[model samples]
Target: MVVLGFMFISCYKGRLLPIEGKVKFNLIKSDTYTLLYMETEKGYPNFNLTIEFNLIQHGKTVKVELLGVYELHILLPAFGPARGIDSLMLTNGLNNLLFTYGSYTDYYAVQVDTCIHVIPIITKFTVYDSTLYGGLVRKPNIYLYPTSPCSVIVKLSPNGRLVKTIPDYDDGFKVYAYPDGSISGTPGYLFYEAEIRDVDLGTNGWCVSQPEIISFLQWLLPEYGFNPRECDDFIQYWGDKLTGSPYYEIYPITLEQIDLICP
Candidate 1:
């Protein structure tokens, strides 16, 4: 046997308006339809509203029978506060039913109308863990941590599936590898790494005496809009160049080997 339930919410605005009243329905042989109404108050001039409703049923299974059987129909008045009406219908078969309502506007409310049809059937069943058809199910553990360095240990289930992992803290930033072979760090550190690599002039040395490279980067800053902190290495390199200690070297970077750091 199958049982169904329905619910709805109505909303309005204003102080003196007639608040919407709850809806009522009748069940014949445990089956019937109901209509709920809400009217605007006298003082309230404008009406913005919402409505919500639910359906439930009880029996041996105690299912929320209205899973997809319920429908919400809203009716708005032409003048004053808008009015809303909701209806619920249930077919014969199942046990008990429950309904709930909620709304967004202060003037909003809900009405529940339940209709039950049909009688419930009774049966017996057996339960056993050892004789269960499917295998046991396990839940995975997820851990979130702040941006910093630390050891990450992940455990696997007996079936080689991810089971859980311990959360720990340490110094350094965490890097995420992408399917495209690129990597990204946290926000601040991401900008810093990009800036350092930019100033390194694709080399293993800093800009100690290259005024031209420093000037070029300064001009390019507008194009990248990178954070100032991210360019700290570049700035330091240029400062050393101004002091007559220019470290210029040519190095190459490829997307696949970006993780490698200079000595």
Candidate 2:
């Protein structure tokens, strides 16, 4: 009789082990985008589910075909290793499958029959610029180029300082500046070149010349939205302060008027 009672309890526990619940699927609309949400049971909080499906617009019996399934799980201390805690899986057809459940007394299940819409893409504007400076005492020439004609935002960093975020360039090409004071016409095209005149000397003499123009040009070309290519020097000139104050000033160009000039 005791052995027979043990068999009956084992059968009852096996039946209780399988999770029983229903998943309620819903298509939610946010501004221009659509998402799928699932709610298990009557009072369970809705969880966002990542799913992709094609919308079939037919004259009759419009149905959702689930292309794939996704799962997200979390382990709880008291529940041992609860699998498929707050997760979702959708079928290509209009069927929702019951996954598993959380360890806490929460019931788990899946409900089908839902739909979500896709969002539309929007475009905006931005600005581009290039600049050069004599690292010793001269003010840098901040050249504002013609605005780019796209919806991408262009941010300016001067001496690694976040100057500002410009909106929408009406100019045709992207503008970029190099550390050695060379500007690229486009992101990769090296259109113009300027020699870096180091006023203060460390180991080098009075006028410091950097031989890494080729490499420096390579680095700045990508930032302005162009590929690196060789270009000819446009401006060649020099100046010396013969006065009392040993200050360096950019000749023939002002600090504020260095607009985007390609070689």
Candidate 3:
């Protein structure tokens, strides 16, 4: 799911009216097909409206307009002879959505009335083989910081098995959290690995140089709410291996996707 913020007007009683609200874009995968879901906070309450769905990719655009629709959750049709998953992966360029496992970038737009919204969608999926028990989910350390002392219960729903866990998961971690970001009767942080049988790697990512890697993380980590020490620790852990190559491709997973993959 990715949110490209914009405001739009609503149509009511054959009149165009301005409304102040936002909408969300989601890419969902099912056993049969991939679907695009669009929703808005302030939508047509009592009726439906005609909408134009626009798809742009690799310098080409396809447009489809529908009548009497509220929210959208449509299975994209075949562009030519390509059909089903192959059709989605080939022509619609949805294959680009899988940057790593289930991560994706946007290539769709929506038009209502005269408003056009271009969105960049990002998604993440983790492929864990239940039979072999193998997906090396790397460093996942939990940091808890609250306003004051409070009891905290942290739980994980890994698709596979947990290889390591601090404080021994014991179904869930029960601890006392404090303002200083420390837990009583446990390590200051939590760490674990969710492993499965196989991993699917994506070829799409930022190919960054060594110096750019340092500078980028220095800036990017802070934007994601990482404190100075945490940021330093992240780069320190992964810096050496990345710098070995002239440039390395970096794929970032969103917090939302993380929860979806292993809530």
Candidate 4:
């Protein structure tokens, strides 16, 4: 049931659009092109008009225009036809309607009439490249990444279900704890149990960037006192063997070696 585009401002009785029977699809215009798509469920509000803008050009106008100095961040009417195939190019005959998507084209302009219906706002996300266990802050600890790194930037919670929930990147981004103590959230980062492996920086390790993986997981998890080291797959075993020689340091950690072991 691909439904998430909704908009209903009100006023267009002679059939410019607002049919409400939820028109399925069959209006491929030409009086200067008029075919729109992507209307989700929330667009049940309807639309008409009441224009007035100068907060630098009230997004130009959805119609009822007088002038237009300029401004952008536009996504009018119920919120979107933005899922892929988008269009709104009409300039005078239709009174102005420019709203492109992705790297954002046309920038922004509005004002239209003559078959325009769309509702699209489903762009959730989740992916990684690598990370696992580290103070992502206020810990229940179990981080790992590897599914859309860098290019996908970083994002998680497409709700694949990791109910253990405890992810917060403070918003300024830059949350990497990866010397192998693995923790991530730059631009975007959200992972949930991928069997976990990748973080064996070994050979006198030296993390490489973002201040050496945040000084190697706060010097390998040491909050005053001393004894706080986890890794042998984060010790917590049962049927797969359990015990106490639990000392895992996938290498790469320093702060003068936690000031030579918890100074």
Query: What tens digits encode model 1's per-residue C-alpha lDDT throughout 143-170?
Result: 2243554433322222111112222212
Q: Compose the digit string of candidate 3's lDDT tens values, residues 237-262.
A: 55543433344555555555465546
Q: Model 3: which ten-residue window has the lowest total lDDT?
A: 78-87
- How many pairs in model 3 have backbone atoms within 3 A of each other, for residues 3 or more apart or on separate chains, i.e. clashes? 11
Measured by TM-score, how close is model 2 to the native structure?
Answer: 0.16
For model 1, give the 10-residue run with minimal summed lDDT: 126-135
1 or 3, which is superior by lDDT? 3
lDDT at 69 for candidate 2? 24
Residue 89 of model 1 has an lDDT of: 49
**Overall local distance difference test of candidate 2:** 0.25
Q: Tell how far residue 181 is off in model 4, in angstroms.
A: 6.3
Q: After superposition, how far is residue 168 of candidate 1 from its true place, in Å?
A: 13
lDDT tens digits by residue: candidate 2, 30-114? 3433233333232211121223334443432223333322322111111111111121234323432221234221111222334
Candidate 4, residues 100-172: lDDT per residue as tens digits? 2222222222234554322322212111111211111111233334443332223333111222333543322
Best by TM-score: 3
RMSD of 2: 27.5
- In model 2, which regions exceed 4 Å deviation? 1-19, 42-263
Of the candidates numbered 1 and 4, which has the greater lDDT value? 1
